[model samples]
Target: MTAKVENRDFTADLNNKSSKAFQDFEREFKQQMAELYQSITSYRGVEIHSLRNGSVIVNYTVLLEVPATATANSTVQGISAELVTIVNSYLNCCQSNPACGLCFNASFTEVTSAKADSVDEDLCDGQVPEGFEDYYSPALTALGVLCVTVCDKRAASPYRCVHGTCSVERSGPRCECSERAAFWYLDGSCASRLSKLGVAVGVPVAALAVAAAAFAAFLLRARRQNLEYR
Candidate 1:
């Protein structure tokens, strides 16, 4: 993107054009481009600059990032040759079996980008998530990332925490609910509370269940004694 090779996206131009041949291959062209991408694994991507001259002329560039084993095999060049062929084929392809003059042009640009396997996993620059305010994520520096998203925990107020308190941690902000003795908060929001009446009623019902089991055991014992006497 920094290179800014093209003025604008040319695919958009083809989409707006009112040409019969363009309309015929519009869907297949996308599929063909995707298939082309699947073949090349070492390069950056195919940057389509513009598709002009009735969708027959293609202007594009492929960015190349050098590998550790540079040119060790012919995989890169072989695929590049196929890319040229496939792109040209898409340009001339039409459903009506009519000839539409099409040509393919590609520019190869070498970029000194990061290694293919090294991915930046740090999310220190990530934004404060929804329902949180006062984003204070540390900017990435040469040393390392200090912290990720840090919401305003000092005074999160009724806006962020509602009826709870907020605290910042490595994983971001957490909400601690504050509920009354006879009530408990629902979920972690602490906005809604349910009365402890159900808990109070459950105690006696559980005791009754135990008493019924004991009575059944005594009746079984009595029946066993009668059978022995017989």
Candidate 2:
């Protein structure tokens, strides 16, 4: 059986698709922001559901999974970066525009409270590690009123093959892959592709070579036996 090969060309195709996916995300995010801005005036009392310390709690629950691509060339990172930019811009606007105070304060408080609640829930669930309260409390408190909440699915690298598998890492908001599986470290995902492809190709070739050698040996023995009988 010629190892059922699904043309690896799909890698490039998948990369293209991934790029398009990210582009779509960017467009959708912008559209959503435009709508959010129009609907929720900056002066309106927008309640912040998750605030801790000074920083607003950015809950990433809104965006869960980013579309994966075979090559990992996606617009997810760019879109996420853009989102950070938007958040920063919004925060700056809030700081500069006194009219934004009411909305900003409310949102900030809500975010902090939500984060506190999340921490509390984690503790109840036993998800909070030892010394976590001490570490998180001060950090959360220090965030204070002026802090910003960056809520997004997660930051990720464009290359997926370099990263063996995608999972959430505790260090900030990014998808993480195992060290052994990762090609490079950037937002927890691997960034290399050439190395990953090399390994994938090498394994199949090695298997084919072993099979060929065994077949040749069997053929040689059969030929010798037939000659001796003749």
TM-scores of the candidates in the order shown = 0.28, 0.21
Candidate 2, residues 144-224, lDDT tens digits: the string is 211111222221222233454542234433444555552434443455433556668889999999999999999999999
The digit string of per-residue lDDT tens for model 1 on 69-97 reads 32322444555565555443443333343
Cα TM-score of candidate 2: 0.21
Error of 1 at 50 (Å): 2.5
lDDT of 2: 0.34
Best by lDDT: 1
The per-candidate count of clashes, in order, stands at 0, 22
Residue 210 of model 2, lDDT score: 99
